[model samples]
Target: MLTAKEIDEQLSILQETGRKISECFSSFGSRMDFKPSPEKWSARQVLHHLTDSEIVLAYRLRTLLSENQPKLKAFNQNNWSATLAPEQEELPLMKSCFEANRNLTIRLLKKIPASLWEKKGVHEEAGEMRTYDLVVRNTSHCLRHLEQLQKLTEASQAVKL
Candidate 1:
């Protein structure tokens, strides 16, 4: 369960992380390939993954805030990452999607009633999680990816010199 204040804080952190991610993408000198690593996603793929996750999670937040505890569907992130076409390295597209979704998430969090924060949803694997917890987790997910992107950028820069 989260108070409105806590939700607001999480929203702030999410928005800040989104901004940092955009900055990171903008800093890249050349378009990175989709096949940088066999096991790991390339920078472009990572951005695409984040965009997809943001869109899906934003919808989930809306549903959780608007309706009774709904049975949320789970997704296979690895499969999605592998299947999504990485034909273009569109940083602007990724940044726009992230910004729009994050703004919507912040607005939704602000609108959700404090009492409803404790509403429970059944995740396929994680079992039951409170709506607030889900939102918090989603924000944390963005931060984690942002960190990964930063590390990738640093590693690439190191290889240049």
Candidate 2:
């Protein structure tokens, strides 16, 4: 089990994720909405998805920490990306929203006792999920989107050459 301090450190990293993503795609602002294919999501869409995910995950985490055997809802990310029309939103706004939402989560986590980390919740899709699972999943989720954005950037760079 990860200690509270360790978890806090991880939370801090999560808080900075938006800033890192913003810097990584600063040059791609003009083309942040560019999708290499009809099936692919652009950097802007990814940011919007991430911001929305943070909001959902924050609520999920709070449920696990405060409730016993909470049943979490499942969301189809692709549906959100499609309906949200993220391509029309400003990139910085999406990134800033992600950072702000994540900060709220981190602040809440800092207040919870370490023992609460073991509390379990029932996710509609993933079945059993512990508080610790949420933390690990959050980190991986952000990293996965970051990797996707990186690939998108590389593809655009190739086209520029």
Candidate 3:
């Protein structure tokens, strides 16, 4: 179980990471396409995926905090990624969506009672996870994808010179 302060700290880190992502994308001229070696998600695709996830997780957090619901529906991330087209290099839109969703999620987290942190949700593949765990996991997920984006950007830059 995580305290509210800890959750806020995690949210802050996520927001800072989002800012960094926005800065990095601003420096790019051409839109990157999803590559097979990188597991088929381009820089933009990854951002889109993150945006979709943030939306879902934000909803789940709201439900957990407000509805007293014990189990929320599971999501198929891979399927979702496959379904979303990668044409949009709209980094600004992606950043805005991420920021909005994250701010809402943080606000919801702050309002959630500490006693309800242990509420459980059964994911289809991942099995049962606590609401607090879900929030922490989402933060870590964003960090992992951000690192992937950084690595991809570095690799692309190296190829240019």
Candidate 4:
């Protein structure tokens, strides 16, 4: 179980990922579409994924806070990514959506009774997870993708428009 302070801190870090991602996108420009390897994601695709993930996590967090052990639905990220159109650069919009959704989620989380952090949910794939666990997992998830975005920007020179 995570302490309230710890959860708050994680939320802060998660919120910061949006700012860092935005910066990475701005720095990389057209190279946001660059793939370090054939199988890897481009920065733009990662941003889209983050925006989509945040949207889902927002609902999951809300449901965990408000409902009894809601079963969280899982979606195919690969399928989502295939449709994200990474070639179309819309970094600012994607970053804004990610940040705003995370902000709303943090506000909601902050207001909930600390005891509710123990609320249980069954993930479609991961089996049972507590509210605290979900938040922690997603916090790390955000950090991982943020690092990916950074790596994509640093390793691949931004292509000229």
Candidate 5:
């Protein structure tokens, strides 16, 4: 069982992720579409991936909250990036979706009783996961991508300078 302080800290990081992503996007300027190589994902793709991931997270949480031992689905993000995320590059809209969904998820999480935090879901690929596990997993996932965006931003900036 995670301590309340630990849970709060994770939530705080998750909340900050959207703001950090927005800042990174703002800083990207001309580098918004940059990719380090042919195989690498550009910032726009990452943005879309994050947005899609958040949408999935919301659904997963709802399933966990309402169902007993729900079977969770896993997606191949690389495939989604190639097929779905590239259709549009509307940064503002994507940003809004990401932030709004994240906020909604956070609000929903706050209302969940501590007893329910351990609600279990069996992911197709990841096996068993608790509601709290999703929270921690997503916090780390977002932070990793935020760092990736920052580095991509710097790389893109350097090339243009």
Candidate 6:
């Protein structure tokens, strides 16, 4: 169980995610498609993953709040990236989708009662988790990929092409 203060901090981080992503990608300029290697994802692909993750996490959060110990499904992100062809996705549209969904989720989080944050759910792979756990996990996931995007931008700059 997280303290109220801790939960507030986590929510703040979640709210800033889309803005931070835009800031990080601003440095990438024309290198959104630049991958470190053929096997790895590009900045664009990471954006797609983050957007997709926000949508999935929102659904999980809603389920946890509305149901009693609902079983949450796990998604294969790598497979989504490969099959979705994020490299071919339009940057503006992807960003809009991410920001819009994130905004709606934030609004929902803010309006929910504090006790609802403790609502529990069972994830297929992660086992039992509280709604607050999803909040923390999702925020950390966003920050990790934000750092990845920053590193990708640096690597892209280093490459002549």
Best by lDDT: 6
The C-alpha local distance difference test score for the whole of candidate 3 amounts to 0.72
Ranking by lDDT: 6, 5, 2, 4, 1, 3
lDDT of 1: 0.74
Put down candidate 5 lDDT per residue, 64-139, tens digits, no spaces: 8899999999999998898885647678888788888988998998888887788899989888999988888888
- TM per candidate comes to 0.87, 0.88, 0.80, 0.87, 0.94, 0.94
TM-score of 1: 0.87
TM-score for candidate 3: 0.80
Q: Candidate 4: which stretches are off by over 4 Å?
A: 158-161
> What tens-digit string does per-residue lDDT give for candidate 3 at 1-161?
66668766776876787666666555555636635365666777777788888888888876766665457777777887777664544677877887788777767766767776777766656677777778778878878988888877876676653
Candidates 1 and 3 compared: the better one by lDDT is 1
lDDT of each: 0.74, 0.80, 0.72, 0.79, 0.84, 0.85
Each model's backbone clash number: 0, 0, 0, 0, 0, 0
**Residue pairs in steric clash, candidate 6?**
none
Q: Which has the higher TM-score value, candidate number 2 or candidate number 5?
A: 5
Better of 1 and 5 by TM-score: 5
lDDT of 4 by residue, 1-161 (tens): 66868777766876677567656657776576788888998777887887899899998888877788789999899998887675574677777887789788878877887788889999999989988888888878888987787777777854333
Error of 2 at 111 (Å): 1.8
* Candidate 4 overall lDDT versus native: 0.79
Model 6, 1-161: lDDT tens digits are 65789778877898787689756545566887898999878888888899899889879988889999899999999999889888778788877888888888888988988888888999998889988888888888999998888788789889999
lDDT (Cα, tens digit) per residue for candidate 2, span 1-161: 76767777777767667567657546675677778888998887777888889889888998888788999998999988888888778766766777777777877877887788778999998889888787778888888888898898888777752
Order of all candidates by TM-score, from best down to worst?
Answer: 6, 5, 2, 4, 1, 3
